[model samples]
Target: MSLDRRLATPALTTLLVVLIGLVTGCARIPTDGAVRDGTTELEQASEIGFIPAGPTPGASPDAIVQGFLTNAQAGPTSAASFAAAQEYLTPAAWRAWDRYVRVLVLDGDPQLVPEDLEEGATSTTVTGSAVVVATVDERGVYTEETDPSTVPVTFALTKRADGEWRISQLENGLMITTGFFSQAFHLTRLYFPTPDLAWWVPDVRWFPRQTWRTDATSEILAGPPEWLADSTTTVIPEGTSLAIDAVTVTDDGTIDVSLTSTITQATADQRALAVAQLEATLVEGEGRDVELSDGTSPLPVPDNAVISTPQTRGDALAVSDGALYRVVGQSLVDLEDAPSLDGLDPTALATGPGDRPIVVRDGSDRILRLSGTGVPDVVMTGRDLVPPSVDRFESVWSARGNTLLVGLASGGVQTLDVDWLDTRTVRSVRVSPEGARVAIVSSGPSGRLVHVAGIQRDADSVPTGLSTPVQVGASVDQVDVAVWQEDTVLALIGAEQDGDRAVFVAGVGGQAGTGGLARVLTGVTEPTWVTASVGSGAMLVLDGDDTLHARQTSSLWPPVAEGVDLVAYPG
Candidate 1:
């Protein structure tokens, strides 16, 4: 987003009028209905020194040129303004105004000049187009500078199909120099409909159907001619809005939020409302009042409620510490409860468990380790890296001293070991009871399915190859897969399209292997992990409800009240 002062404001004003002229004039000025003639209505207008009123043959070329000039200079605000400007030039001239003058000048003040020309030349060549050259001696009313710079400028005025003459080009470096100035017009109109729209999402980021507002201050600068703005208003779609209902802190200290209405599907109005609500919440903090358009009461948040960090014992979640620890008898401490994970360094750990959990303390440049006796114990105080800004591992398993694997966005796998980092591309990672493994549901560069290798482990060695990549037979509606047992279990990981949680299962890995992966349950909220009896066919399912459900592995999901914040099965 580049902002060049010369073209930022004045250029935008000019371009806006030109676009208005083209779109408005396109319909109001009728062309030869049948493509029966080689000369366009615009072409003929160029020859007569007039632009067409509508699209009459031999219309004045001057009229078309004047139309373009007037519209470019004066922002078109109505159909009449547009129609009046279409009379002076030829198709070529109108094309130039539409293509260059309006875009390069009105949209922005462009520094246009002849790049190349020949002597004894009645015309100059710019971008392979010929144009007449001259110097402007006139000056604008603004008297800031006593003298203005004089330079040669070129403009292409040509006859249209109908013999009408119009501007063909405006020679400016704007054709090449691009940034905030050149794209301002496009960006404006692109965001014009939802002038409040900040982004068109997915292409900008990866979420779909989401439009964001840059800020409450950015407004739609230009509107179509009066008639068009009114007529086309309905073209914009509606959006969704949300209202808060209740907020509660759970016994475990995690916040439990309940809403009377959240976005199920959004309309233009609903979406706008949602954006407004979100902005208010973000700026003023939660529970802020948001007025609705329908004259309903403003949404209010519950008092005495506060948001807190999530604490879970799910296999998908890892724990780290930021405290002092003795190498031989290390004890990990929760960074939140302790003074701070001040001096610990993850990379400098002399020795500890092969898969010791660690984390970089928030807002602090220290590392903490999670150690344990009966339960996991957090050991703080470790070595620090050289560069203070380098981000250390947020979550990773150390295979051996100085060797660790790091997961990253775009399904990339990074190995930081032996004092070097090597990146290997892969699909997303799926965390399971045993460890995190790469999912096989993704495609390789060759656009073919790849096979998944089974999990492997060696005595006294850190686990490796938790699951091999596999080439699935068909395109599956799944993002990740979870492993419970060697072959008797599997679960889905990550969020899905519908927003509702679900899990699929398969029995292909074990002896009776006929039940390949299949959908076993639906509407399972926040389903992230699973624990089942080896072959008993009974399983425990965890949900976003932060509760556990014990169900027959073969039956549809049903929650059992037996739940705990932390659960463990003895090896």
Candidate 2:
């Protein structure tokens, strides 16, 4: 449906007026709240059977309460933790409690101090102050509320018939101290296919952290989330679902999944595609083999399947000096043959079909572009013009204050007809891989916060406007760069509360993986800039020392290249 070429104008006077006026509005150096508590480290859980048991049966009241809060709050997430938490509560209390009511996170464990609940009775309250960074609603909606009001979490006790003290009543919902979320819930993803079928798309989902090979597989079988409804496709047959609730991982780390008998009715190609989906989702299943439990068909992943993931080494491109280069490991291979970038000095770049999308500085300081096709003519002007992001529709989008300027491959310039433009300033913008969502750092009454908005494009892939904007979390104050590391996650490089530089990643419509903590990329601090591709394995960053580094999981960011000014990747 793309027409291949779009026309744009060379007007700078109008764009400059808006930029100068907004510069003096309010100068708050961008800073994310917290994440430095070692929450950024990635830890994978391989044993689902492990559970933190409570303190001994005859422990003191204060010890019993603290131990119960710690032992019972971990994963397999909220879904199954209730059954495990019953050990800490009386049988009657467990049955009447609602585990999903709300998650009350304390900065540290609840402090147990003697307080008078009744004139003649003794009570215990928080011994140490507690602060809640965020809250997850019943429907799993995550809200970043750094300073939510707190209520004392008190535990009541009683003596049973056997004369052993047990907790009779306690707060509902799962509870964990500030830094234990990663151990309680695995920040996992479900894979879906892009409309073009050339790339894979990952939709973020949180499962109770455990050896949950079945949790990841079942969610993938349920298909993509509603926000991604029309943007992505699933390979599983239309009605096919997981046939077994418990699939075991062999000692050798191979996963054999059993699908509903309905899979027998799928076509040869559908079956092959289904297996590809299985292979991608279960790659984190701590296993090597993803075979149909029915044992009728062979796993069919083509030699070159695009299994896009956040922690991956994806196709990365960069511009060194004035020439374009594809970052192949440590070497910068020049891609000078593309006619679109001839005779121009490129200052900034973004991901597109071939990494040809660039921002050229027309004057000594101006950076502008006319994007669409391999190369389109434009009158370049201004440095405030950040690199435009190319969405899946091939339509290019750039931010100027609150306005989103769109350049459709079909033709013409259009301002996104979105309503949020009047309220928030769009700092850095990155469209989701499926082109159905936009992750951006927006400023409103609450200052700058990271938000993900849904996009609505016309038939020709031209963006009309955005709808249903959702805040990712409240961990960061201002976002310098917001780019998609995978289809579901965005790698954020910004300042921390004290103005220290950090990198935080978040899912499109869920809690940050580290439970609202800013997951910092350890080795490199104050990176010059950060870049990531949609189907990438690693997040490439340029440190303040001019050293290029790549970070994936816990390993230190190994240097990739040197003398690199700006890094870029495919859209």
Candidate 3:
């Protein structure tokens, strides 16, 4: 079955079951169920349903507050669920509540502590507290709180005319447990186009299982996020909206998108780009297509229009003993027709589009471009320069301290302005595969920081500057290296709380705890260098002993090559 059908029927029913359990005052909701061993399916196939219950009469202030908190879990997804929860609150309090403001995901069940009430007092306050693991903004953007902290939740209740306790005052947003969050919300990717329209970049968003399609389509029309606004462009015309306010799938497996009259003003090229963006964002697996219409008339997309998918080169590049080689199986083979590095003492290497190699010389403070058969050309020279990275546009990117320098394809190098990295030393800089975003590792008063920012380019696709950066992997400390594992994910070498250095995976936008910020490998001794293949998620690391290791299916990092110094994949 298609993913949309699976989610629309089974997964959505599972969410409703969990929400109904919360409203019915179930003591514990089972997040996981037993599955048969050797099952090939990714998720279990089970359908469970329940009827949500409202508040019980004569309940105490503590029960009312607890019930209110539990029922609020459904507020972000279902209106009926929120209305059922409102029975525990007074009319004024319910009217004042705004569930769309934000959502706080707790580490576990919240603790309700009732304040000491005076004799015959008509009102009492119950204080709720829990360790927040993550938060969802009004835009449905999920930010994992790496440094989990305890936050206070307040609820004030009073006796109504029927002598039943009803909440009179409370915070605005919904508070849900992490278990509930995992079951109810899904991580979705919304695709945007690069300035040149050659590749698509993914923007991560979290939506409830029942409303993901509508939410994703609306967010696409609204444009990219704040930090990514300047780097990416959308062909969807301004002021365009969904005429029906919902995206529906037909029995023929086609996604029907009806737009407002504003889309009618867009040119044919604009419509084509819009269709490509929609297909990339909405179509998941094979055998699915997007059908667009401006309510009445069909908006056709050209059949021959193509937008290439971003991918790295097939083989990884490595430098050993002043020679460049390609990693093949368990051995390193000499690169064919490669430029000689007899006395240059190359230490780091990166390949750009068309297998163009750029190397950094040890102790020379210079980056050189190596052709098939010629002398190496000096591309960039600076003090304390990190390894150089070449983007798809063939522009070499390197950083000296806090300064960001880019070597243009036409000629001289340009110093791009990065106002956010003030006074901090840049450790590493890497451009995304599509050349739409750049990942930077830097250090300041708050230890090491990993940031991914959008790269702004002019009309001619020349490097201009960077947009505001969004920090990722905030929990990891003392980061030494950060590389792009995939379009929206990063591989980081950092430690947590002075622990041993380990390999961690973090999403581009602060998705730390929820299947992000995961520690993949540990027990490596004083690792110095790390690299990942963008085409395949393969990773390699160089330890202090000059031993090169590759990650296996398990946590083991077995030695792949001995006496290897540096390794990297094409950017």
Candidate 4:
């Protein structure tokens, strides 16, 4: 939960530090070793998936990665040797490895040199294991090769599994630009299980130009054309690693990613970068790719945007053409004519009048009565009905005919009896398109307040349902009522607690729709609220500055509507 909050909000860059100094400890590859091509050997081993010896037999995976790194630096340049080393890569990790190796070693410019490499470093404590650190000598290459300089490099590595060791991080020691160069190392983390590859002295530092050739089966190793292994998924729990099959940005603002990689914590973190980078790009319009780190794109998002509630069938009838109607259904069978408050604000919608009286609440915390005669009479208006403790009207919805429920930011429910225009304190209330029901969110003194569909027979009696409060994502902190598809009740949940906000949709059915929470969209800045239009697949999210921001549910890309003024509904 805490981690989700950190990721959702604006935060510092994630750093990697292990691979930085991995080679420093054992600087030289074994002197007498032959550069045997282990390519065929690794390919054969990878055919059925790299299965190392079971529990009591082989060395741990980390030890294996270390062995490979040491061997690579020794003298072997065989494709087969590198293939043996490829066992530690994830699908995505492999791409990062391939990119790095091609750029820094095989096709390197040849002017860069390491000044030093650090070993025996410690990082954050992991689950039962500790994170380790390392450092490497950094080199700077002039474009024209006239002058070159050496820079210090540092890295952070996490010690995972008893046998599974991974080059969990990499970074520059200096913090002048991004302040923490660790993010650079995370690039290959999504692909490589261990950071082990030979270093080539480059004359100048420039982007590597080797292109990877991948099919459903064949994969590239440290550089392009170096076929490493063939597999659809790389499982690294034991001897396996993650691998990336393909990554491309479509013309329609969609990022299509194909993964043949392992699914592990390391892989997840690595994939998060790719996903974040893509999502950030969508959030940022044309010409601006989100580049968070030197290696990853930092996505720029506005501080906030307004979130919208879904428009439902019952609500749809009332909101079609911005006109109003009275809807009643045993199961959406009957809807009748209702009086329209043509000049009211969009927020003033709760219910309208027909043969059955409609209960309505407004921004003023007052319960107004709407009748078939097109007259809106005040039923209970003022502090007497709203109570002095209530702050502001966050939302208002109909529980049933002539019964209205009002939600306040101060955390209290107000039930208004429209027949006599009286008020009462209700434990809980849920307003569904079918009817209104009272519900209990939690049994103990502390829990999320739940509202469910129910009924009211008499002014003093209320019948509740079995439904519970909708369960939201772990990090969700707030929600607004939304009606979508007529039957589904949705609540737009704010997933950030630290002023960083993204919106999610939760069905307001039984148990608060625990099974129906969907991650509709993310990467919005200061998203105070959200609402969705069912017909157009569009959504409106409010920013912290009280602006109505609109976007489509299908694309969720940027060029979204910003700062829409909220005003009275025009007649």
TM-score of each: 0.25, 0.72, 0.87, 0.31
Between prediction 2 and prediction 4, the one with superior lDDT is: 2
lDDT of 4: 0.29
Candidate 2 vs candidate 3, lDDT winner: 3
How close to the true structure is residue 126 of candidate 1, measured as C-alpha lDDT? Answer: 29
CA shift at 159, candidate 1, in angstroms?
77
User: Each candidate's root-mean-square deviation in Å?
Assistant: 25.5, 13.4, 5.9, 22.8
lDDT of 4 by residue, 1-571 (tens): 0111112211111111122111112222221211111111111111011112211224443343333343222112223334544444333444454223211111111122222323543222111111111111231110111112333333223334443444344321211111111112111111211111111100111111111112111221221111112101122223212234443344664443333322233343444433342332223346433222212332233332221221223221233334444222211122356566565433343331112234444445465545567667554554323211110122233333224544332334556453321232222233332222222221122323223322332232232212222232222333333333222334343434354455555433211111112334554566654444333344455566654444533324343323332211100
Model 3's alpha-carbon lDDT is 0.74
Among residues 3 or more apart in sequence or in different chains, the pairs in candidate 3 whose N, CA or C atoms overlap within 3 Å are none
Q: Which scores better on lDDT, 1 or 2?
A: 2
Model 1 error, position 516 (Å) = 3.8
Candidate 1, position 493, lDDT: 45
Q: Which stretches of model 3 miss by more than 4 angstroms?
A: 1-51, 74-80, 117-121, 512-525
Error of 3 at 353 (Å): 3.3
Residues 1-571, candidate 2: write the lDDT tens digits. Answer: 0000000111111111111111222222212344432313223323223334544766555655655565465444444445545665689887877865666554444546633345433333333335566565443444566454565666677656654556787667766544455455555556677555555656555455554567777777777766665555766666766777766667787777877777777766666666677777666634486677444354444444444432332357666655556787766776555335556566566655554344443333344453545554553333365556766555667766677776665656677755765787777777766666788777788787787776655655566667656666456556777887756667787776688777766656444444544455556788667777555456788878767788744447778777776676666
Q: Show where candidate 1 strays beyond 4 Å.
A: 1-451, 454-468, 472-475, 485-488, 494-500, 507-517, 522-526, 561-571
- Candidate of highest TM-score: 3
By TM-score, the better pick of 1 and 2 is 2
Q: Assess the local accuracy of residue 407 in candidate 2 as a C-alpha lDDT between 0 and 100.
A: 64
